[model samples]
Target: MSDLRDAALVSKAWPFEEARRVLKRYQKQPPEKGYVLFQTGYGPSGLPHIGTFGEVARTTMVRRAFELMSDIPTKLICFSDDMDGFRKVPTNVPMQEELAQDLNLPLTKVRDPFGTHAGFAQHNNARLCEFLDSFGFEYEFASSTEYYTSGKFDEMLLKACWEYQKIMDIMLPTLGAERRATYSPFLPISPKTGHVLQVPMLEVNAANGTVVYQEPDGEKVEIPVTGGNVKMQWKPDWAMRWAALDVDYEMSGKDLIDSVTQGGKICRALGKRPPESLTYELFNDELGQKISKSKGNGLSMEEWLTYAAPESLQYFMYLKPKTAKRLYFDVIPKAVDEYHQQLRAYPGQDLKAKLNNPVYHLHGSDMPASDMVVPFSMLLNLASASSAEAKETMWGFINKYAPDATPESHPNLDAAAGFAVRYFNDFVKPNKVFRAPTDQEHAALADLALALSSEEAALAAIAKKNAAMGNEDDLPVADFADDDFLQSVVFAIGKNHGFEPLRDWFKAIYEVLLGASQGPRFGGFIALYGVKETVALIQAGLNNELTK
Candidate 1:
């Protein structure tokens, strides 16, 4: 839907200016130690959505830049409010009385009826942390559960609630929402009577005394007046977070635009410095709703690592400002396409380079990288192998065609490739989605079946004779540009040989041979074994004993 030039990383409307010379007032600090980055992610009712990590990942680039910007340590802190009561049920996980009772609250206090979390909020917090680290996010993580239980943030929370009245006045009107009568700046559940109530706002009483919220139901509340008492509401909390952690920048989704509005007001109320806020529209599914784990509509970042490279995904994130409009989820397909296309744009050069340079941000995320359809020959050869062989084999080919798949071609790919391979295995798996033959290609399958049944072995010998191909790693790199013979046989064999292409081929080969398509590349992959072993792979698939 966009005819925007690739030069702008898909910014059709406005050109991005990554060249801001002067740091804002709040961002100023000693050159040796750069901005301290802190971001919020994880109630962890289930796994974090792509949107959640999107914020962290975007912030990471800034941190890395700051890492280069500073001589001293640049830090990122990922805070998880695991102590919050579970607000709602996550799909696929069972909901029960405990969940209903704890609804509209943080997840740390909820009971996992599915029996996975095992009667604790801490388990889900761990899951969220695991998920974040899995996405290659570098963060110093903290949990609200630990923070509160250990009294690490008691002063802050107490102060915030103490100034609850003033904070509420500024925050509510800013968001245009009225506070509920029963709502308190803080929520308290009576473990004894199962009564949930909010304390009434405390009056300062014009005296030197600690004031706290009083409930209409008759419980008198008070607080100790002396300490480093400072409080802020949600709106002001944003600014306070910046001042507290010395945040340089933060990117939030549009859903938080109102919160930021409210937050900005709080900053003014508290007379504290606020962090600069950048807003990206939330990534949504085809149904056009925000991707949320609670709604079961969001896919995890780890789920995305499969089927596409992480750099490609990262490239996808950077192509446009996170604050842009129309941030489509389907953009990933475009992202993938551009990655492949860029690889093909300069065949024989290290393809991983395509993922490295800032130029990698040229397209959207969902697109496949190349237009050079994976020669059916390569896919067929791969499908007729075992998972280990297929994994080894395919990675070899990808590393050859697209250098970004392995770190040997480019060191940055080292961590990224390992993630890509494992993500595919765990999330997508060898059998996740089948590469079905096209309807227009009906004759192809029948002809392929014939080729396999007859004249196949002798032809296989001919294919072997015509080929010295190993894993892409071992395949002799050459300018085979005009080599029609090599191309012909490769595609032809694919037409008559394997049922799966690159992805499924690896998956099926792994399934039939090693029981998974997730090892090394195929060119060198087949070499680790040999033709006889490769032939056995094809036979195994025909026999349908998958687990074997």
Candidate 2:
């Protein structure tokens, strides 16, 4: 354990690096709050998406890293800013006209369009918690409405009131003259209309913890900043929450860089330092447009999960977070395969290497073994060639390659088989384009098919000879089972038929036989799908049977 901790101190993984930065904060002494506090804020104005989950997932990764390197205990809080006003109705939900009527109301007060929960924010908050819990994250859920109305934030709310001018001085310079004249850090909730108003504050009485503003009817009213009567603007609210909660570490999207800077200044004005933060680049759609929840331009968490396991999504999140990447359906298969690839490499890695591995951060010391003996890409190809409708169909092929494995023993592989079938049908099958082989390629494929047939015949003759010698079950099939051996045979055939550089031969095999521009190693695919079956597939391609 001590050696692992020593390795963690110098580990180059991003999580450990971020954790070290946080660890520096308490080098002189322990925090006055007794434990480090990690927080992730959410806006429940729209449905929680993959980007929202990434914030909490990445924060947890750093929190896990910090736990590994220090004796200090830590706590994570998933804070939902459900108190923000519902500025516009979402186009995706039902009862849009109803939601439009409730504009300018706090999300917690707006009626749920789905008619399922207490309010719009509550429904979305439930979804946010469901996905977080589904991932088994360790954290406490905090609601902005609950904190304000329950007096948990009263102290900071009062502090903001007293430091109102200071907060204004920090925020005013960032705004134009029109918005600057009316902007107050505090937004008062109107009593009569039940709307959160953005009107100019007529007065701020720090002594009484109240702000005076004229109602829409022109009546002068004094509202207490505490007790949910007023909510701070997002920027000030961000700072006030940090001071109130004593957050040690938090992370936000790249778009929030300026907001983070302003919030840090506001926190300094309120006599507290801001939390250590990482600004991660936002995800983009396939076309490179920034993914927007309202615009519905990218894959959702649910959609990603439908075709791959949740860990793959986390694996995607765990990559170079500072580098922006496209988040779309096409990225799923690669993420799934690479996640298992990392899992396979974890056990053999030395301590320092393990410390740098993602699975170590993702699963910690309780990492599971990678049961995906068949790579996801290979499974997709097998499903494509077989036109598999059920996982059981893929299992027939998987069992031929790994005779001892089963759904119970290799659950990951079992689940991936299911995912591969769905992925092939939904994404691959529709786009598949098989072209007829050219003359040279056709002759090469025929010779390759004949060669595979001879290999099969030789294997059968060897099995018969072994059976006559009372060694049928123990026959030396390893040589024939070897992917490289079969690959070499195919390479020899391709080279004999004038396939210079070899990659063109493989590319032709993929485009002509598999209807894909690229595919898994033909040797591995043949080993999994059986030598005779691949010969039949090749013959079908040559005769134009597949394209027909």
Candidate 3:
């Protein structure tokens, strides 16, 4: 193994470790190709979802890690299996009845239901490209229809024809008795109807590179496998792709673990070694059901990007990919907040720590030097509570809290504020319920409001005291701005009024102010919302004057 690969194995970073494992396997017996190749596959059955983005993004991250660890050149192929037959109409697409008419036909041959592209596959493929391009992903896209029809897969198709019997033996044992009795690795496209035929093969002529199958109309026909006459069944196709492209690494959802195993066997049977594979856990919905594009059961990429930055989604995928996580709209705020926190810490980190940071990897070599001026969660709150329509309105509040900041200087904050406004209008505003505070909670908030109203006076006094002590430049703003100070102040008031353990007091404050049990740090919230406005908000909550 190279020094870089060795170092990667010990780094303990998951992406690096994954790359190290793949490289180690290659080192044991190198590939036919000189450089590494990473592949991520998409079935153009529906629009790209969060899972699609996750697969491509995670694969890209692994590819990046491999590039960093070794001098070997690398390529990532975003392959679309557009040649696959349309088994059923997608629920999310239009003209479902029209799409159903083309059942069992290659997706690329089906009419574009949305009227936006040449075919069904083309429409989805175009969408996938647009989505990936928006995030500036670097990859080469290959369409299976083009590959097969243009003779790029001729040699592999002929080889599969020659090894048909052997491939059948390898696959049949894994199938049910009925399937085992009739299964063929190749499915011929009927010359008459243009539908892919799944009929039983009568004979295979290895030398002629053809298979004879009885069509639905009861006619036995022989067809070449080489000239897009036939397509490999998915398992065999996956194996053939691995061998044909000499894929070094690839990943799939955990549901494909069995297929990966079967593909490995089929590849070895074809005199080619299977690629190194990782089966990551699939994303689940809030109900704990596995998220599926076909089922339309989880959050969409559009929904995520609509509310948060692309980097936030990338960072969410970067973390613990091997474990299943809920991909829902509710998770967006935390992901956005986490991205900001990482960006903030990135500059202070050492080289090793920087490399380990998710933000550093998300940006590749062009890591940003600073964090956003305000947390996205806070921005969402500010935008929703104030009904801010434009970035200027949010910026007005932000500037009031952090006078040193500017929209031009903090472009990320500006952009985030804009997204938060749109997101709040669409998702948060209609759903939010502002509850009136309890009498005890109301009393507590009233006291906190009184304290906030006096904050300016306290700050002025501190400044005067500092000036007298010959430390005019070192105002005690940090002391007051700290969460500890806010916690201490809330705790002291709550303790005097018989509310125990400061946490309940803080939770009550959050519930009254933000309509949640938790929120952005109170000190930061107060600063961003403006001390006077926060005091008034608290006073409104106490008086039960806020709207529910």
Candidate 4:
């Protein structure tokens, strides 16, 4: 374990360094239990979203890192705050009318408007389990309602009741003047209406562990804090949960930094220390605003998996956990490409380097030994350029490139090809509007077509020229070697025609041929799609047939 710590201290990976810090903290003040606990929270007021997945995935990664570095047993708890009241109905949910009527009631008490579960909270919790199960996350799910009703949290609730004044002292300073006078650490369940009441506590009897509060109908009622008669406010509840579960680590979004700070204070008041906490920046939508479930502005978990692999989404979460990232459709292809690149490079790296790789962490002990047949971005380009609508059409070209490749042997590539077809249709096809080439651009395209028609001759001509210039070794070893042959052929044609700003030449080729301003490398596309088909496509663009 000391060797593990020493090795982790020198590693460049953030997860390793984070694990080192956590282990050190525990050493200083050890947890009450033998095993280390990692917790992630989800509020069951709404359906599971992408942010929910991000938190669990990241926490699991850190937990895995800690498991590798120490002999300590580790447990991950996916805690659901299902006992919370439904302040308002989310726009994305069904049965808005019924939900609106249940405001101020605990989510577990509200009816399952979807008619799929026992209650609203149960529905969301089940959905969350379904979502996490899709990714095969190993976690223990704990419901706040069950914890409260089963008396698992009775000791913490009683402690909060006995120390109510101290908890109030810790929380009041952080609230506004108007809320300070009315605030209470315990919110009692209304016996009349079955809703969680936030009204002021009229009286407190710490000796009896009971508090009296007024309901909406002006009825004063007394209730015990134990046996699920009351629940603490958010900050105090967060602190109590940490102390009750002996949580070693937990993480939340940056917006909750103040809450964490306040909760730490409350934890101290309750005679317990708060858990180690991390604050990660929130995800932003394409519009540069925070992703809101009510607004429905960002990609959902199902939407992302619809167009990309699950590993790609996990990889996205694995990168820069503390940095804010855009979770939109446009970021999907790049994430897929990066995942593929890392997987391809994983087998060649040393042990430490391999462990540091995102794919290695994302896949854990089940990391694949081989790379995908091709890059996902290239597959997208191939699908778009070839006008293919089915995975079979794309697989034809992939099989041509690697004859031995089969779906059974290369599942990632097979999955990527299917996703590429879907992605091209949803995101790429509608935006494709080819432009007619000008006369000068047409001449450039003609030269490019001629070069493609006799690629071997073109490469030989460049090799002869290079050999004459005392740079014989500079000749390309293969047609696609470093794209040397393609670059030489294109540059020779451009220099002969005196074309200005060679970028416009490539732009013309892209816009006319692919109906986009940018795309995969032209040389690779030609090599993969074949010279004859590319020549014909370029000729169609030159003749103004592409715009049709």
Candidate number achieving the greatest lDDT relative to the actual structure: 2
lDDT of 3 at 436: 79
Model 1 gets an lDDT of 0.48
Prediction 3 TM-score vs. true: 0.92
Please list the C-alpha lDDT of all candidates, in the order they appear: 0.48, 0.91, 0.81, 0.82
Report backbone clashes per prediction. Answer: 61, 0, 0, 0
Better of 3 and 4 by lDDT: 4
| Highest TM-score scorer | 2
Instruction: List, residue by residue over 1-548, the lDDT tens digit for candidate 3.
Output: 36444555567777877888777866665555877899999998877788998999999888888878777788899999999988988788778788889899999999997898889899889999999999888999999999899998888888887777778888888999998777889989899999887777899998998989998888889999887888999999999988788788989998899899989988887888788888899899989998866778789998888888888899999989888898898899889888889888887876667668887668865877554778889898888657788878998889876788887788788889888888888877777667877778877677676665675544544454455447646434434455455544555556645666767877777677776666666777766777677777887777776654
TM-score of 2: 0.95
Model 3 residue 23 distance off true place after TM-score fit, in angstroms: 1.9
Off by over 4 Å in 1: 1-22, 26-35, 70-72, 95-98, 104-106, 113-120, 149-165, 175-184, 188-199, 202-218, 223-239, 321-337, 340-356, 359-548
TM-score, per-candidate, Cα-based: 0.58, 0.95, 0.92, 0.94
* Candidate 2: clashing pairs of residues: none
**lDDT string, candidate 2, 315-396, tens digits:** 9999999999999999999999999999999999899888888888799999999999999999999999999999999999
Deviation from native of the Cα of residue 266 in model 3, angstroms: 0.3
Worst 10 residues of 4 by lDDT: 475-484
Which residue runs does candidate 2 get wrong by more than 4 Å?
456-478
In the range 1-548, model 1's lDDT, one tens digit per residue, is: 12222322322221122211113332556533354554654546665666666667666655443333334455677776564545456664565555677664445556666576554456655666776665657688876555545655554455554455667676455442344443344444333333323444455532443555544566655544223222223345355454445554566777788777776665555544455566777666666667777776655566566545565566566655554433343354456555555555643434333323333333323333343334322333333342322345555544444444444544433333344344444433445332323332334333333333434433553354345443223222222222332233234444344435634434443444444445334434343234345445445445544433
Off by over 4 Å in 4: 1-6, 28-30, 460-501
TM-score of model 1 (CA atoms): 0.58
Which ten residues in a row are the worst by lDDT in model 3?
474-483
